[model samples]
Target: MMSKEDKIYLELEDREFPFSYTDHDRKIVRAIVFDEEKKFYFVRIHRDDSFGKATLIETSGGGVEKGEDLETAIQRELKEELGAEVEILQEIGIVSDYYNHVHRHNINHYFLCKVRSFGEKNLMPYEIRDFHMESLKLSYEEAIREYEKCSNTKLGRLIAQREVPVLEEVKKMLLIN
Candidate 1:
């Protein structure tokens, strides 16, 4: 049997880029993994010369590694970054955007996930500075309000638009509101 890593690599290697851009389009993915406790996990990335200052962003799971599939990439990313095992429940959606003159092709796959366990979040030394696990007790309205002051990241816009309804659903699931 092929190893999980091998299977993931094969899937990514076989994928072809149907669309092209003048500038190289880098493929990326993100996850919206949540637990039964209604807490959402996010990463606080430290900015450097290439990026900027420290900023809070949604827990993203992606990178078009040679021979990796979308699902495999996400699963790998979740485990790598959060040090947690997650079971993908459903794919929420996808989004693509361009920023800073670079065309970023992000096949953002939002998944309803359950964290089986937690350990020390293993962040890439240069990519992340810290992380936080927040509860959904904060109202959607409150979340939207806080996002506005958060550097106006794409994740913020998603929350403002109520694109990922899992946050709301989780609150309801736990009877928080």
Candidate 2:
């Protein structure tokens, strides 16, 4: 069994909603995806009032389908969201966050990934219509700013809480190696 120090676990509460519990769990895979230039790739989403009418930058990922391994799910999410083939350099750890308004808990598995190549994106219809999802590439400082800027929205706050620490961890790892 792994000790507490061996894993990075984050638990996030839903302060924006009055709901007190989560009824379902979602297993997800996300990446801090970078290219040879050291710029990171993310998804910029323009959402409506479901969360709020705001634009947000988020790590490119989604729910891991049944029977899909974490590696395969991350690979597929990158292909569909960013049109890039990535090399999974490291498994960062997990973030346990709640979407109380939706009654769902997210078990987010994060990875440090490097882009290998690019191709056409095959986005789902809902992702295109509902999220207005688009790919964004940003430097470390720019990404930090984007996260802070986007935190004006409810969903953005949750995303920033979940991702920013992981981003910092990845920075330290890169500096060490």
Candidate maximizing TM-score: 2
Worst 10 residues of 2 by lDDT: 1-10
lDDT of 2 by residue, 1-177 (tens): 122556567777778767877789999999999988888899999989667688999999999999999999999999999999989997888998888888998999998999999999999999999999999999888899999999997888988999998888877777733
**Candidate 2 similarity to native, TM-score:** 0.94
Q: For every model shown, what is its TM-score relative to the native structure?
A: 0.63, 0.94
lDDT of each: 0.50, 0.89
Separately for all candidates shown, the number of backbone clashes (residues 3 or more apart, or on different chains) is: 4, 0
- Per-residue C-alpha lDDT of model 1 across residues 66-174, encoded as one tens digit per residue: 8888778887887777777888765544444433323343344445566777776566654543333222323345544445565364434433333234345444544
Q: Report RMSD for candidate 1.
A: 9.3
The CA lDDT at 38 in model 2 is 84
Give the clash count for model 1.
4
Segments of candidate 2 deviating more than 4 angstroms: 1-5
